[model samples]
Target: MELVVARIGRAHGIKGEVTVEVRTDEPEVRLAPGAVLATDPPGTGPLTIETGRVHSGRLLLRFSGVADRSAAEALRNTLLIAEVDPQETPEDPEEYYDHQLIDLDVVTRDGTEVGRITEISHLPYQDLLVVARPGGGEVLIPFVHEIVPEIDLAEQRAVIDPPPGLLEEPPGVDGADGADGAEDGRR
Candidate 1:
């Protein structure tokens, strides 16, 4: 699987070097020279790091053959991706990549299947899982330990025990008072 590592920023100086805003917390390990990067915007092509170093808390990267300001400027906002081996060990047991969480089934403590995780939204306080129900609705479940009690990645399922009234919508709020809302426990 390919993991996003950084986004290309403005060109640094007149050379083909560009400033990269590292997305991973372990920037030092990911932004090393000779690392292969797949550039998005599709046709901009892939880049092989000729040289890479941290500068002003961001990454300064020089890609092989990209030799001028124009070349670097064209790549602004392109996402940098690295092909990650699935067998590679995770940093921690609890630490899961966003891609791994996607499509996992979500269930209740009573063995009731609630929905399947379709997407994950990163927030300042906590990550939110977007669960798509079979009945054509979505549940916004917070990724808190209190709510999501268990996750079996091998089974591709998660168990949740949401607080009371969390799934209830206030009266007269459009379609918020649906059965899926009750399952999501989003107030």
Candidate 2:
């Protein structure tokens, strides 16, 4: 199982150092110096991490053989993938790898079918589960313990306690409720 650990961002200087958007929780292990990772698009990597550091909250890294600005600049948007053990779970039980969450069945507490999780969207504030609904659309479910109260990996399901209007269309948006007239019903 290969998980993306980072994406190469813009070159930081004339040297080969480039900024990376870190994607792994265990960056110290996955993006550490001397860690060689596979790359996406099939041939650009097997990039070895020569050095790594955090600068202004962004992870910066240099790779062996990538010794110039142009070399680093060309690596922008490349995903660094690391092989991970399927049995390995994060030290914190609350934290989960994306592979564990994707493709899980999503249902309400009462067992009403909602959707299936297709992807995990990581944001600066929180994560969201992109659920593909049975009716042919998708909904972004906020991945919090409050709403998503249960994750049963054994059952391959995620139990969601969605707030009102989360699974339903808004009542008044674009007259979706179909009462275009005034409340007095004079129109």
Candidate 3:
């Protein structure tokens, strides 16, 4: 299985060191020195990690043959993918790889069908599950234990306990009833 481990950011310095937005939890194993990663643009890599360091809380990587800032800048926004065994699982049972969550059936605590997991959005603060709703739309479900209480891999389902408005469309703001938040045509 191929998993996206990181995305190349801006060039860190004059050297071929580029900052990366780390995606995978096992960066020490996946993005360590001497690891070869495939790039999203396909032809841009199989870039080998010549060196890695943490500068200003960001991961800086220098790829083999990429010797200058321009070379590093060229890699910006490129995704770094790593190959892994399909049977590999995380050390912690509570944690799950993005690949494992994708395609899992989504249901409410009451067993109402909500959608299917299409994507996992990894933000700096939280991860969001992109679900394709049965009625032909998408909903972003925050992948928190409070909202998503259970992930049954053997059953291939995610049991969510969403708040009142979570699974539905957002209501009017400022205590109004409509989208514009106005019962009369005043404000």
TM-score of each: 0.72, 0.88, 0.88
Global lDDT of each candidate? 0.81, 0.91, 0.92
Q: Which portions of model 1 show Cα errors greater than 4 Å?
A: 17-26, 50-60, 169-187
lDDT of 3 by residue, 60-129 (tens): 9999999999999989999999998888889999989999999999999899999999999988899999
Tens digits of per-residue lDDT for model 2 on 10-60?
999898999999887688999999998999865888999999989899899
Q: Show the lowest summed lDDT stretch of 10 residues, model 2.
A: 169-178
Task: Using lDDT, give the best candidate's number.
Answer: 3
Error of 3 at 89 (Å): 0.7
Q: Give the total clashing residue pairs for model 1.
A: 2
> Candidate 1 lDDT, tens digit per residue, 1-187?
8878889999998889999876654556666788877878667768888888677866799998899999989889999888877666558777677777889999889988788999877665788989987777677999988999788988999889978865554565575557446666865
**Two-way TM-score contest, 1 vs 2, winner:** 2
Question: How well does model 2 score by local distance difference test?
Answer: 0.91
TM-score ranking, best first:
2, 3, 1
In model 2, the runs with Cα more than 4 Å from the true position are 170-187
- Which of candidates 1 and 3 is the stronger one according to lDDT? 3
